[model samples]
Target: MKRPLLTRLLALAAGSLLLSACISQPGPAPRATGDLGLVIERASGSVQLIESTGQSSLARIEGLGDLSHASVVFSRDERYAYVFGRDGGLTKIDLLEQRIDKRVIQGGNSIGGAISQDGRLIAVGNYEPGGVKVFDAQSLELVADIPSTALPDGSRNSRVVGVIDAPGQRFLFALFDTAEIWIADFSQGDTPQITRFEQIGKQPYDDLLTPEGRYYIAGLFGEDGMALLDLWYPERGVQRILDGYGRGQQALPVYKMPHLEGWAIAGNKAFVPAIGQHRVLVMDTERWQQQHAIEVAGQPVFVMARPDARQIWVNFAYPDNHRVQVLDSETYEILADLEPGPGVLHMEFTPRGEQLWLSVRDANEIQVWDPYRLELIKRLPADSPSGIFFTSRAHKTGL
Candidate 1:
């Protein structure tokens, strides 16, 4: 109280410096997550967060349950990943922090999930009890549960497959056991307005929505045709396309079901894996008619297109699982055949299509390739990886 003015000023400065020193320092430099991705290690029930630019693993997140058949979808902001595990686990992971933000066991068995167009709702399709559960994106709270139609015996609900989000906050899915397709409109509220399309086909195994979200096509396993619905004109009902695609020939035993989500579109042509056959069916997208059937090395699992729509890359099921072939889009010629070791599970293209990332399960590695040059660029170690998902999917519809 009686100190000189200069002495009091010096004391105040010393106290301010001490307070600043006691405060916690910043942890790390802020960075963006645009180039980040994840690789699913199916056997270990974990995911490896990776950086696409460096083609390197950044962190390994563990403790997810039963990832034998897992799929992932990203939020609209591309900051979080929603992993749908076979054991009904819906785990929300924070990509920036490399940690699980929230998790819930929504069903007994789940196939996959999709984020709503508005990015506010997460929808999961289940297999065990068979239905769809919609949850709040932020809190992972159950907002709605729409059970599939009951089976003939009334013992259990029909298995749900091919869940995808469409325009106007709507979800479209196929009921495998009931041979039906349903559209759940969530624009109203938590309780969605349901529209059911009956007798779609037998065993609608999987489905895909076009990039523009105009057409929804479901592939049939019990028959040789596909069911297509025009989302723009729901009143027209479902139409059968590519009926009896087997051409009256005896079908071969299918080792693995060809995934419809791997459907490829180049210009006006669509390339799809033919079930129980060693061929890729090319269709004219305008008419939805089979244009050509290109013979391949084995039963094709994934027939995916390059980003520029210049070429298509195909992977096969066992015992031809070791091979991958690139095909010319216009000429329909086999460009290259690559043997990147065994068990080539999945392939994903970078945002600009400069590079392609593939998961080789048996080899336990992720291979990065220059798609245009058809050259191997790098290899990163993973544990029995099955699915390689990039954040670019967050911007695409029905991914």
Candidate 2:
């Protein structure tokens, strides 16, 4: 074995080369990544597709008309996004291809819309024509047109708000000028069976369905409290909850309307923002009564609970709009007061409630935060952003 040192050295060199080649060998092809969510750029009339895992932007889709008050809902498969715009534009976009599949002008002015339980029908709430229109989700064809013409004065139109899809293929909406909530049953055909509940409340501004889509709650501007309709038991009609909640108290001048989208339910208590007041109403959901009120520095715009229902995050309208406050869900105590920059329009928690993404309009950026640690993690550049929606919304109801 010691006879030829050169032969031994040559063998060692060859072995080393073989080992290096093996170590550098390519493994299974790297799986493609970064298909995640959408960021609504209000001023630009476009949506920037972003990947949450990587925290990166993929593409900015343009030509979406009048995205000033745009909202989006995904297909059942999450392959397509239906964008409802303020200019009455309904666009079906192929998310995989990053292109618009179909577009239609459904009305002159639109606020928002909802998708059916089966994802087969899309209903839009219009302000200009004051009605809700149902369309075929797949082909974007008109199926039903239910106008809000049944007012006490026999008016032909009334501003529509809070259009939501309930269980059993029924679409429920509230008319602003008419003060009514109409339930449109589409189980039979295009001409839905309209059941109108009138005089529910005065000047219902906006409405939202509970996380489970069981209750439809509408906020009123002309009055103090809200109207609650139990979809599970429609025979009970509409019950006005928290009547004169602001009675006797001198409400501060509201710089902007308090959005009901911020209302959240944590541990059977629903936290709702008080219009023109710097506080949130704590409600016991089971009894449907006001439990307590949590005071804040400014009028709350969005009072959202963490996905895990541990903490409640509150943001303001203006003046104090630059600050965000976190409260302990159990103790109802202030946990942390954070300044996430100016113009905090909306906040969306990840599906698991680990992280929060907030849209800062004046700053033109989206800030990501760790709710548990109360620290800033990342910041994304956006143009007058409003809503931060994830593709995971497809799996859940009333997103």
Which parts of model 2 have CA positions greater than 4 angstroms off?
Answer: 1-35, 150-156
lDDT of each: 0.93, 0.86
- Quote model 2's TM-score: 0.89
Q: What C-alpha lDDT does candidate 2 achieve relative to the native structure?
A: 0.86
1-399 per-residue lDDT for model 2 (tens digits): 375988989999999999999999989763332246778899998988777776777788998889987888888887888889999999888777877899999999998888888899999999988899999999999999888865567655899987777788888888999898889988887789999898888999888788887988989999988999998898999998888889877878998787786688887899999999988889999878999889887999889999888899999988998999998878889999999899888888877877799899999998889889999999989999988877777766654
Rate residue 359 of model 1 by lDDT: 96
User: Root-mean-square deviation of each candidate, in angstroms?
Assistant: 2.0, 7.5
Worst 10 residues of 2 by lDDT: 28-37
Q: 50, model 2: CA deviation in Å?
A: 1.4
Best by lDDT: 1
Off by over 4 Å in 1: 1-27
* Residue pairs whose backbone atoms clash in candidate 2: none
